[model samples]
Target: MAQAARRLGVQMACWKAWECDRAAPQSNRLAMMAGILAVSPSWLLSGIGAGPLELEANDRAALLQELQIASAEAVASQKRVQQIVALLGSVPVAGDSP
Candidate 1:
């Protein structure tokens, strides 16, 4: 579970809370969790839909595409953050003034 949580980029306590129904991840994380568990997000949330094993080939392909898009977006976002940090590094910090 610790490894799974780390892979999910969540703390162990947050993962445990999800396990205990004390918290719920947002919808984006729902999709990630489903992929990790080989289930559908609907099933992962409410146990009311087919899981990955039960999905048709088209459904599987669609999910894979969505995951790919999300992965690309995450990479783009990370690059933007790095650029912003680099830009911030060049800004002058002033000394405290009375």
Candidate 2:
């Protein structure tokens, strides 16, 4: 966000204000911001032009499947890590009396 603010040549507070609708970007800044955000200037100004890409139904389904698989893998990995931690907790230290 800081980097983006720098690129837009505004302070972070100013950027945040625009984001929160507490302030609005000037005309020139609007174009720069649109470029930085990869949206059309018209869209940025009035929400009337090319905006973010919309995923097709098939693409959305594929992405959903991938995310689900990654989530399941993460759960499995977490369980394995917890098991390892429990095992380590029971192991005796090298210099400790058994």
| TM-score top scorer | 2
Best by lDDT: 2
- lDDT digits (tens) for residues 15-78 of candidate 2: 9999899999898998899889888999977799899778999999999999999999999999
Question: What is the Cα-based TM-score of model 1?
Answer: 0.50
What digit string (tens of lDDT, one per residue) describes model 1 on residues 1-98? 89878888999999999999999998888788888887888898778887657678999999999999999999999999999999988776688443
- Give per-model TM-scores: 0.50, 0.51
lDDT of 2 at 14: 98
RMSD of each: 9.6, 8.0
List candidate 2 segments past 4 Å from native: 1-22, 25-51
**Candidates' lDDT values, in order?**
0.87, 0.93
